[model samples]
Target: MLSDMRALTHRVRLDRRMTWTALLVLAVATLVAIPFDWFGMWVNCLPDGGCQFARNGMLWYWPAASFLAYAAIAVLYVRAARARGLGTRVLPYAITGAVTSLAFPAAWVALDAYFSDHPYPEGPLPYWWFVLDRLVMPWGMIGISLLVLAWLERNPALLAFAAGYLALVLLVLPMGDGFGSPHFGIRLGMALPQLIVGVVLLLGAFGFRRAARRPR
Candidate 1:
């Protein structure tokens, strides 16, 4: 019996180690991708600097990163869920996160292509569709990120911080009188809030990890 118990303990430790290693790799990948312009390939600016390029850089980046990050979290959540004997509950979230991650980018690229060639406000597309295509999609991506954090059972403080940051982003999205108005101020506002949120999330993840490792 003692030998069996020892073996189980060893297995548990190994599992924990593997989980931590995978989480670390996912975290690093997310950190790297978050800042880069992953959707630049989809955009092409014309000489006139008109809607030729569809300069929705923030519109593209946030959703792309959110999807990727959430997919990672979903994986972690699945492992945790399985360990806790909640496989039925966790599998759906994991699958949804992965699907949404890929779908978000595809949708953004599709929108960019459609708008770039057709021109903005062509009269065929309704204004509400435009709002959905621009604002709703990005905010949905942020919502996915929050959902992933909730799945991971992250620290409450971290969750609150993310919530506040997302609220700020949503507020700012409509405030600039559409895109590129007061370009510098809009850029500053967007970048600064994201930076703050990213830092806070990182710190929170670290804190959660440390607390998890501590003996109860």
Candidate 2:
């Protein structure tokens, strides 16, 4: 009985560590990627420098950033589940998120192609698709990240990350409308929620780290 209890304790500790480490890595990767996203935003400011052009640097940068961020979140979910002996119960959600990650960039390309060529005499696919590609898809991934992690563990930091991210999606994102506005301030405002999420997540990650190190 004692041996079984010890093994269970060990698994719990492993789960805690793996989850915290994953959160830390995700936060750091996002912080690193922010500059690239910012550069993309800056490029959007140039005259006729919209991301619709294949030549636009944001086409390269933003997608790369998205890949890194989502990849980390996926790994976190898988590893955390394995640590807790959950056997990938949440893996499907992670996989779905990974697949949907491509939707945004694909949507961007389609929009650009249709607009540039004017192939359809119709009014250029539904504008709501732009909303989906810009706001729904990207923010949905953030929701997935929170779900995967929070399902396993709930900490102050995790809650903060979720709250801040949802605030952005619900409040800030609509105001900026995926940075579609011509106004530069509105575009930059798009970054505010992203930055808030990263900062809060990082704080939570370190908070977990400190708690783990505390002498039991």
Candidate 3:
């Protein structure tokens, strides 16, 4: 029985270590990638048509792809931690991420159907839809941030991440293209901070999971 207990303790320790490693990796990745993305360093393409308006522009594709990747990683890591009997506090946050993961496709289809007519309907649907859809990404991030705040009060990285994104959103609102503009579509220069924020939330989710797994 003591041997079995020792083995179980070892497994738990290993799992805890793995959780910490994942959190560190996620945090470092977020910090490293965000600067490159925010400053437009990772891409060789200029904002000029030669790059920005190209058929397959890296600037446009990068953020869209990266956000999706972040969503996937966050959901998977949270679920994995929960399955291992760790980070139960993060389950709701994981569900939020999962829903946000689907928001992209759902928004795409819904927007296509709603805006099929050039003039669109003469109602509040467009306005509300525009506001709600745009809010979905932020909502997911906020959920994760709150979860981190609740569970890992010592680690302020996720809170900082959420705050930075919120600040960016406030800064960009005045400069934002109207609802008629391709604001909903992939616009890297416009959405870089948001993509980075999504990434931070993802990384923070893992960090929160790590904190949750630690023995009191």
lDDT of each: 0.49, 0.57, 0.46
Q: In candidate 3, which residue pairs clash? A: none
Report how far off residue 123 is in candidate 3 (Å): 14
**Alpha-carbon TM-score of each model against the true structure:** 0.48, 0.56, 0.39
Error of 1 at 190 (Å): 7.9
By descending lDDT, how would the candidates be arranged? 2, 1, 3
Tens digits of per-residue lDDT for model 2 on 78-123? Answer: 7766666665444554555566566657777777788787854566
RMSD of each candidate relative to the true structure: 8.1, 6.4, 9.7
Q: How accurate is candidate 3 locally (lDDT)?
A: 0.46
lDDT of 1 by residue, 125-181 (tens): 665564455334434444454555444433354456456645554444443313453
TM-score of 2: 0.56
The runs of at least 3 residues in candidate 1 whose Cα sits more than 4 Å from the true structure, single-residue gaps closed, are 1-30, 38-89, 113-119, 122-142, 148-162, 172-197, 210-216
In model 2, the Cα lDDT at residue 143 comes to: 54
